[model samples]
Target: MLSSWFRVIRVKFLLASVIAVCLGLAINWWQNQTIDLVYAGLTFVGVIALHASVDLLNDYWDFKRGIDTKTKRTKFSGGTGVLPEGLLQPNEVYRAGLIFLIIGSSVGGYFIFEKGITIAVILAFAIISIYFYSTKIVNSGLGEIFVAIKGSMIVLGTFFVQTSHITMEPIFGGIVVGVLSSLVLFVNSFPDFDADKAGGRKTLVIMLGKKKASNAVWIFPIIVYGIIVSGIVLHVLPILSLITLFT
Candidate 1:
């Protein structure tokens, strides 16, 4: 039962959001040579809660729409197998997702109180998007756009909480983080292409069809590299950050 709960939350995939938060922290430290371990830690908890909320809510909605049942499950793409397996009731999963959403929102609310309207705006967008993501955003072919923006915001938001300002470093770093995160979502969507289309969810893969989508997947890494190169050339990013190219 405990394991099922963990699967439903998709803890394994939480690392992407964690890495994004770390990049934000790293950029802030790189620029200011200062650190706030307390706020950094709090930011991480809040971001992770939001990430989990999205995952659980996504699964709940997919199941509700019957997409989860029709889709071919894969290691990377399908909704967590928990619901279809009957490890938990749909209402149980739905309630759990709400709990995580509330927890995440509470954390964001605290940050808003401390940081002001900037945090409030980002939190509001996140809450609305996450709640409707699987049902509305993906169906509109804007899913990837939202995921990418969410990744960038995580980086920017974390940096803002710590440094109380935005700068080129975090902006460039956020772009890199955002693009890479989108790539993960892009590839994962491949397996769901047919399922998504049949369910009326018009993801990028569905919009472009399989072959064009495969060809377009290369663009993500190129954009990441392009941002890195331009940042280095413009001297906005330190040359050492070029090490990202090797990654």
Candidate 2:
């Protein structure tokens, strides 16, 4: 069952979330030398839990709304694992998501209690964005901006909780992660274009059509890489090790 769940997550989506976690950890580690291991571990777990909650809730919501149909989702194929295929009911998926969300929020609340007040703002936005993404408010094309903010907030919030200070470095790194992760959403939007349109989900791809959505997918990576290279070349960011290549 554990292995099946792992497979359900899918490598691409898992890797993307892993990358976001790495970006958060990288920023925190870079800025702090005496960070607590337990705190860091909790943050890591929080990130993963939140990722799972988002996926599971999305599956549950999509299924409920009839957005995930038999054609769009296969028995072993779409919207996580068992949920869409009728192997699991909506209540089960909803319960799993709630459990993970509680765990994540517990860790996050701990960090907030230890950290300063700045984290409250980020947490507020994070919770709101997560809720609204698939809800009525997000179906009007505003979810893209929320997603971008979500990506950026991970790094900023991570740094704030760990270091208890804010700097421009994490801000820069946040933008990079925000834009790259946004690209992932942009591409994911492509195949779901017609469905999204049909469902009245006015997401970016739904509004732009296939051609412009494809253009966005290609353009985002270019712009992100350009910013990364520009920062390194202009000495805005100090030369680190080979890890910089991936960033």
Q: In lDDT terms, which candidate is top?
A: 1
| Model 2 lDDT tens row, 1-247 | 5654554434356555567666666766765645667776787787677777777777777777766763254333335546656667688777877787777777788877888567767766766666556766448787667677777788777777777888877777777788877776766666666666666678787788787777767677676777677767766555762255685
The lDDT values for all models are: 0.89, 0.69
Query: Any residue pairs clashing in model 1, and if so which?
Result: none
Q: Over the full model, what C-alpha lDDT does candidate 2 score relative to the true structure?
A: 0.69
Residue 122 in model 2: shift from native, Å? 1.6
- Identify the leading candidate in terms of TM-score: 1
Give the alpha carbon lDDT tens digit for every residue of 1-247 in model 1. Answer: 9999999998989999999999999888888899899999888888998899889889888888888988898878888889988899989888887888888899899989888999999999999999999888988889888988999999999999997777888888888888888899999998887777777888898899899999999999999999999999999888887888788
RMSD (CA, Å), each prediction: 1.0, 3.1
TM-score for model 2?
A: 0.85
| Shift of residue 29 alpha carbon in model 2, Å | 3.5
Model 1 regions more than 4 Å off: none
